[model samples]
Each structure stands twice: as structure tokens, then as C-alpha cells.
Target chain A: MAGKAVPNATRRSERSHRAILDAALELVAEVGYPKLTIEAIAARAGVGKQTIYRWWPSKAAVLLDAFVALGERAAQEAEGPGSEAPYAFPDTGDLEADLKFVLRATVDELLSPTYDLPYRALAAEGIVNPEIAAEFVSRVMEPSVQLYVERLRAAQQAGQVAADLDPRVAVELVTGPVTARWLLRTLPLTHAYADAVVEMALRGLSPR
Target chain B: MAGKAVPNATRRSERSHRAILDAALELVAEVGYPKLTIEAIAARAGVGKQTIYRWWPSKAAVLLDAFVALGERAAQEAEGPGSEAPYAFPDTGDLEADLKFVLRATVDELLSPTYDLPYRALAAEGIVNPEIAAEFVSRVMEPSVQLYVERLRAAQQAGQVAADLDPRVAVELVTGPVTARWLLRTLPLTHAYADAVVEMALRGLSPR
Candidate 1:
């Protein structure tokens, strides 16, 4: 049914691309962002440095791609095979329950060692490196963050949230605490934590 | 500081210690964390390697001290000299106003490039290295964080915050958004942002 047959050369190149990305992810986790190098990545991937250079602009670029790929893989695993839709914050009529559902999944993802290691590396680099930080936010973080924003907007319309509230900032009430606990690790990142955050966000901390 | 001080020797050692911390901060900002080293810090500080090792355990430790020193300096500058009390969250009896004041101050600190660069480096390293992270949290972050817990507790007693909520987790509602905004740079870290976070946290985002 296809117009053209896939060439062996193209397929081999695709394999090398995936291998290079995987190698980049592993090396960053093992040695950290400071020690990771193109040569090490090349050796680990069994590819020439030139091949990598032909595609990615730098080591951080490659790692960002790898991180995205890993996140996509995680998302795919959650939804079963061939799922292409990005993560959506649930919109059950009960806003608190939906938020708790999403934030709890987020807590689980952030605490996982496999994702956590490479993410920490990338995030650390992003903090100091403005260029990478911007890209990481726009490309990787913002999309998911927007999911929360959209859900908040919907809740506001449903009269679960105040109509005048900025959905962007309101989303932060739930997400910010989740993120803080997740990043700081001062307290346990648990479903209980997510529930607390959602309840606080919805009920307000003041005596109601 | 107490009993057995040889004035000249003690003063000189203190000077050298300050110099090492200053150098550590400067180099981390300039080269980023990955390139920072003990030798470089020594050279920058005009001290020998032994001088540094005599005082701090590692480059990370030195930076942590430097960051804390910088923060203390900022706090002192804000309150004027001879202010012994660390930054206490304002207990103006208006919970929203007090939180807004502190979070606004936090926004300014995070956005200012002077503290931001070195802070970013340390935070990045802390993410990957659990040892440094724990120390950074316990030593640098926790004291200020405790201020929030105390303030929230006061609010609870005063009939401001809901008594059932965990003050520890509730604090995250204020902190998380500030941190997420600061770290991501997806939005401007500003007073307005702090105001929004405080409003959302206190009033609840839902129709109240």
C-alpha cells in the first residue's frame, strides 16, 4: 500500500539515533552533566561524533531530546501502546478529585529514580544555563503546565473556581506545592501530599 | 568567638575564610558548577589549597556558606545594621499581607542576577548529589522555611488559616508557585505574581 519501500540505510540511521539518545541519557545519570562529553556519548552509542554533530547542536540539546523521548515513553506506558496525545490533567466534575489524580501521578513520576536522575541533571543544567532553561521550560515543562492551566480555566467556568481568578496563577496553587515537595524532598512525595495540595488549593487554608 | 582568641591569628583566619567563600561564589557564577574546582577557588581567593581545606570540606560546602552569607548580607541590608533577628515572616496580623510581603521579597531575590547565578549552580548540584542537597536544605533552606511554618501556625491560632490543614504542607502552597515561577522563568517573577499566589492560597481559587 505504501508508495516506497523503506531503505536499510534509513532504518539503520534511525536505530543509531535512538541508541545515541539512550546513551546520552544513561551517561548523564551516571557521571552527571559536568563529566558528560560527546566522546563518551559517541563511544557509548557506538557511533561517530560526527554523526551526532550532524543532528544535535550540543550535548545539552541531545540530552533534552533524550529526556523528551523518555517522558513520551513513560506517557505511552501509562496509556498503553501507540498513544500520541500529551498528558492531560483530568477534568472530572469534582475539581479536587481530578487535581489529586493528576498531581498524584506527577508525584510518582518525579520520585521515580529512572526519570529523576536524568531530570535532575537537566534541571540543574537548565538553572544556570539560561538558553537551555528557556528551551526546557518552553519545550518540555510548559506543555504539561498548560494542561493544569486549561483545567483550572474549565473549573472556573464550572463555578468550582472564581470566575475572575487567573487560571495560570491558580494552577500554581496545586502545582507549585507539588513541585516544591517533589524538588526539595524535605517531605515525602506521596498521594497524601497531592491530596493535601489539592484540598488546600480548593478549600483555601482560611477557615471557610 | 568566645574564650580563646588570639586576636591577630583569629582575624586573619576569618579574613581568609571570607575570601575563600567569596572566590567560590565568583568562580561558580563565571564558569558554572561543572568547571569550578578547588584549585581554581584557591587561586581566585589568593590562598593556598591547604588554606581552603583547613576551613571547608569541599567546593560545594564553600558555595553553600557563600550563598548563606550573601543571603544574610541581603537580609541585614534590608533591615539595616545590628538587626540580629533573621528574616521572620511578617506577623502583621494580616496573613495575606504578611505572606505577600515575604513572597514579594522572595521574588526580588530570585530574579536578581547577583544571587541567581551562584544559587542556580548550587541548586543544580544539589539535585544530582543527595549529600549536598540535604545539607543545602537543612542548613540554608530549612531555617527560613521554618519561619513559614511558625507564621502559618500563628495564622491558624488567630483564626486565619484552617486549623486542620498541615501548616508544613500548606506552606508549600505559597512556596511552590514562587519556586516554580523562579526556577522555570516561564513567567516574570514579580510582586504581582507573589500577590496572585497569596490571594489564591488564602481565598481559595474556587467561588468563596
Candidate 2:
């Protein structure tokens, strides 16, 4: 009877964990990050505030985990079942085509309503909060950026990219414009814009 | 007697205006944007909250004006007395040299503690508030970006840049990476980093 109770307890804990994360995302979307509270997250998740405190130190931690989980779920769906490495960068022989394909997908993801609100809220919070900013840079940004670095290194090995070009800095030439346009709202982020960015970065802005 | 009284009134109003702008900037730096209030700004400026309300509709308005005023003040100092067009882009006929100069200055300004906190707070606020974002893009971002466009156009005419390129999009290739590195804090923003970005954009990433 005691062994049966332990399995039941584990299942209940897992259910509560999912509920809390979902609630945090939903509340941030509705109220924005400044107004989001652990108390509110608890109320919506139907869990005690103490339960949240026991698991996470602050609202930022909860939100960060929720976002990371969302990304994992997205990757799993995109890769389909039985894929262990869903986050791998596509490395077709053509660097330009590979970059364009990935960037276009990014443009779509950034503009999607499913990811926009919660992500924007957290991003805004990170901007003003140094601790959150450090966490975000390390956990969310560095990992994704590393994918591009790996792809660029592979391209260099193929002699498609300039041998001396730092893959890290070179990656910025392709990724930064899309991000700046999206963040600053200076122009509409489009597939065409992504394609143009890749073309310019590859071909050079100077007259060939 | 009437003329003298009018001049005195104008002087008093100007003093109050400067005071309010200074207070708003200082308070935002200390408390962050989410907690900034008109009442606090009023008290710090030694004026009633009604005075702030009369001049601006909200705290965001006061903060925006304060930032604009700071930029104007900086421009005046940089350009010196009796300069009408202080905001013009530097065009030395060498596109690489000109871009490197301006971007290096920008790196200095971004890393300055005086500009860093308040500017970042406003930028963070703009991320979550569409209304603020639109206003900022128009009032702050667009104007500075247009300077780059004008310089790039000059380069195009001089046969330095590719004539077929769009100045607006091409400008992003130069500016986007620096802005991304600064905002995301993924790497240290430095003069060397800015120089590398300009060099890479000019030379192209593909082998000659």
C-alpha cells in the first residue's frame, strides 16, 4: 500500500508542475511581466504559493523555466517522435540556402502570437534586471546562438565561408538585422527581409 | 514694467522645466521605470503633480521628453556653440573610416553609466508597450537611423558602396550586430568588436 502511494504521489507532483508552468505563461501574456505575481500564478494553477516557493525562488525563475520548457516542446514537435537532437542546425552543403531556411523559420516564430507575448514580457524584464539578463543570456540566448556558430564552422570547413572569418561574429551578420527589426519595430519582419539579409551578408555590401 | 514681468515668468518656467526633466531621469535610474510616478517626479522637482500633468499626460511622456532633452544637450556639447546642424553624420569619403569613427563613439556612449541606465530603462519599457515602442521608433530610432541612410547614400554616389543595394537594409548590416551585442549582453561591446563588424560587412564573408 505504501509503495502504491509513492507512485501516486509522483504522478500528482508532475501534474502540479505542468499546471504551474502553464499558468505562469498564461498570466504573463494577460497581465505583462510587471504585473505578474507568484500569488496570481498559484491561484491560476490551483496550487499553494508555498509549493511555488519550494520549487523556485522568484517569479522570474518560474517564467524562465516555463519559456525553456515551451522551447523544448516546440523542438520536439518540429523534430517528430524518436528524434534525440531536435536542436541541431541544418547543414546542407549550401551555406546560403541553409541559413535562409533557418532564418525564415525564425522570422515566423518571432511573429507568431503563441510565442510573442510571453517571450516579449520576459525579454523586457531581462533588459532592466541584471540578474535576469545574465540568466537569459546564458540559458536561452547562448545555446541557440551556438547552433549558428556550429553551422558556420562547418561551412568554413567546406571553404564556402571565408577561412579567417570568426563564425561567432559572422553569425551576427545574418542574425542581428532580423532581431533588430523585430525588437525595434522599425519595419515588418518578413521572409523576403530574411532572404535579403542572408544575400547581403554572403555577397558583401561592397560592389563585387 | 509689463515686459520685465513677462521675462521673469518665462525664466521661472524654464527653470522648472529643467528641474522636472532632471528629476525624472534621476528617479527612473534609481527606482526603475515600472515604479516611476508623476507624484515622485513632482516632489523631486519641487513642483506640484498638477504642473507635471499640465505639461505631460503621463510619466512616459515626461520620461520621453527628458531623454530627448538629454540627447539635445549632448549634441550641443559635442558640436559646440553656434552649431545649427549638430546631428549630421560624419562623411570622410572613406566609408570604412567614417563608419568606424561613428560606431566607436556609439560604443562609448552605450557603455557610459550616465546614459546606460536611463536609456536601457526606457528601451525596456518600450519592448512591452507598443505605444511607447511606436513613439520611440519615430522620435528616437528613426532619426538616428536616417543619419546612417544619408551617409550610405553618399557612399553609393561616391562609388564606395554597391549602387544596387538599398541603403536602409544595408545600413542594418552595419548597425544591427552592434545593437544586438549591446542589448543582449552576449559579448562585451568594444571598439575592436565594432571595427571587426565594419570590416566584415565591407569585405564580405565569402572568400574572394
Worst-scoring 10-residue span by lDDT in model 2 chain A: A80-89
lDDT for position A187 in model 1: 70
What tens digits encode model 2's per-residue C-alpha lDDT throughout A1-208? 4779888988999999999999999998888877999999999999999999999999989999998889888888988866665377888899999999999988998899778877777677887787888888887888879999988888889888999998899999999998788877788999999999999999887887
Computed on C-alpha atoms, the DockQ of candidate 1 is 0.75
lDDT of 2 by residue, B87-152 (tens): 768887899999999889889988997788777777777887878888878887788888999999
Q: What TM-score does structure 1 among the candidates reach?
A: 0.92
Compute the TM-score of each model's chain A versus the native chain A and list the values.
0.90, 0.93
Q: Pick the candidate with the highest TM-score.
A: 2
Residue B12 CA displacement from its true place in model 2, Å: 2.6
By DockQ thresholds, what CAPRI class is model 1?
A: medium
Please report how far candidate 2 places residue A87 from its true position, in Å: 2.5
What 10-residue stretch in candidate 1 chain A is worst by lDDT?
A1-10
**What DockQ, between 0 and 1, does each candidate earn?**
0.75, 0.77
Model 1: colliding residue pairs: none
lDDT digits (tens) for residues B95-115 of candidate 1: 999999899888887777788
